[model samples]
Target: RVRAYVPYGKQWYPYFMRRLAERPANVAFLLRNLLRS
Candidate 1:
């Protein structure tokens, strides 16, 4: 399953940080793909 969130305002930062903390591998995956481009 896939999920998406669109947070408005300054609070988006904390929400994104919490998500990265919870799924650390996602950070690595994102970096990998970013570098590949």
Candidate 2:
């Protein structure tokens, strides 16, 4: 289901974008935690 993924307001856009751009690192961090369990 490919739909337009526009963010609602400008308030959280910057923070969300930054996290999205760093998704690889974020995933790695999560996976590391998962493996630690």
lDDT of every model, 2 decimals: 0.89, 0.73
* Candidate 2, lDDT over the whole model: 0.73
Top candidate by TM-score: 1
Which pairs of residues collide in candidate 2? none
- TM per prediction: 0.64, 0.38
For model 1 the TM-score comes to 0.64
What TM-score would candidate 2 get against the native? 0.38
Give per-residue CA lDDT, model 1, range 1-37, as digits (tens).
Answer: 9897788798999988888899999999989999999
Superposed model 2: Cα runs more than 4 Å off? 1-22
What's the number of clashes in each of the models? 0, 0
**Local lDDT at 2 for model 2:** 85
- Summing lDDT over every window of 10 consecutive residues in candidate 2, give the lowest-scoring window: 4-13
After superposition, candidate 1 runs with Cα above 4 Å error: 1-4
Error of 2 at 37 (Å): 0.9
